[model samples]
Target: MTNLLLLALSAAAAVAPADNGGAPQQGLLPSSPWNVDYAEAECRLSRTFGAGADGYTLRIIRGANLKGVQYVVAGQSLKIRDWNHSGTLGLRPGERAYKLMVAWYRLPTGESAFQLLADDALRPDEIASTRGLVMEFDGAEPLVFAVGNLEKPLAALASCYDDLLTGWGIDPADIRNLKTAPDPLDLHTWHLYDDAWIGKAEKGKIWMSVRLDVSETGKAVGCHTLSPSGSAEVDTKVCVLSVKNARFKPAISTAGDKVKAPFILKIQIREQPATR
Candidate 1:
């Protein structure tokens, strides 16, 4: 989906947790403090926690063809150091844990948000039926929530997910073989040498970012530069090369099926002096 919230939610479904032995037994979980609200038009199922300064919202949104989860944290500031590539968020009921990749963003309301995503649909039963919810992220201490009843809320969320897919004419079976998109470029090969681009390559200090939408045939349909690398010529060159020269390993939706996907490229072009 084009919306950031939906994108994040779809990602959450992509990497769902497996039933490891420690999942909470199917029964009535302890009373949770979470409050649920459904927005059928948007296909969103949400739960709010902590009011005012210490508040956060947990959301599961159904996108055009994907599902995702968002943890919106507010009433505080986040330091750059708080975000590390190695940081992961874990959700556990009992001891069975589901680890998810975490991405951070700033909301228009000025609140900071963290998202967990994958590229597939999530099984609502796994989460709704579990109890004793505890979440751990980024080396910080675990946060425990009183998640009393998950059955009804998760069921509603699942329904919204189905509604989105059906409304968009997508079949769930077609998504089974879908795998996350991967980068095709060996960026190291593109780092300019001192003699390559002459003046531009002398220092090679260029910071640029690009976004690409790839077709199922492994071709980049469109590419746009997000940040310029100082030189217009250099910027244009990078985008052109990425779209024309880069080879992509098409995203597979089935053993023999390929699906369209989006890819992002961020490069800080800098030269390295000879070590010897």
Candidate 2:
């Protein structure tokens, strides 16, 4: 529910192909070959739906184009809904939007393939509104890819429910009763940001990156810092990263002599298990 990824995007304003109906394109144009080797790359994504007798299930796939990846809904039958190409296909009204899952496989060639990256459920608003959802891939060969699905109506309804809950700030009675379902093939993408204060007068720009990893549960871990601007002395003793939302908060220091004029704290949110 937290918009951590959106915050990362605000920092890195990089460009990629349009998410709409654009033709299949390769990585960043006029850029050097991605030097980073991703032989051991992985990624995963999940969303929680309202509790009910009939729970929700969602899946996602990433590729050079929608046609490349193969999938089946509620069954093993290979169905080419072509949600991406058709521009308007996968949606069911009054249903929740399903989560997307993606994995990167090692290719026969030493150079890895950034294609066929992720697959996910589509929100109706996302379908009826934008061309498609664009995802940013980081590594040796960083690239941007688009995804589309007909399941927008279901996603839209689910989104409405989320808005209602968030707006009312109502704690569902079943909050503690929620559980994570089994996922045989887990793939997900995570974005990381490097933030620091340049000086007392100005905040430094934020640096960003992404990581693909298998889904799991763990404690949040990382280093946080506050850099000084100009000649101001920096005191970085009081910085904290929010565990619930992966946000950073700088603590005020009473060390008068050690106080720096222009400094900002750099906070890093380590990976942790995803839970409702």
lDDT of 1 at 234: 71
lDDT of 2 by residue, 116-221 (tens): 3223323346556433323322221111222223354334433443443233332322221222211212111112233343332233322211111111232223
TM-score, every prediction: 0.50, 0.19
Q: Per-residue alpha-carbon lDDT of model 1 for 1-276, expressed as tens digits? A: 123233223322333332443222221122224434433223555554444433445665544323335443322333222344433333334445566666665554566565655344435665665553444455443434345556776677666655544553445454344554544756455443234444563245444556566788777777765455666777677777777766677766546567876555656565323221
Candidate 1 regions with alpha-carbon error over 4 angstroms: 1-43, 64-82, 119-125, 167-169, 176-216, 220-248, 254-276
Model 2 has an lDDT value of 0.25
- Candidate 1 TM-score over all chains jointly: 0.50
After superposition, the stretches of candidate 2 with alpha carbons farther than 4 Å from their true spots are: 1-103, 108-111, 114-120, 139-142, 145-180, 183-276
Question: Where does candidate 2 have its weakest 10-residue lDDT segment?
Answer: 34-43
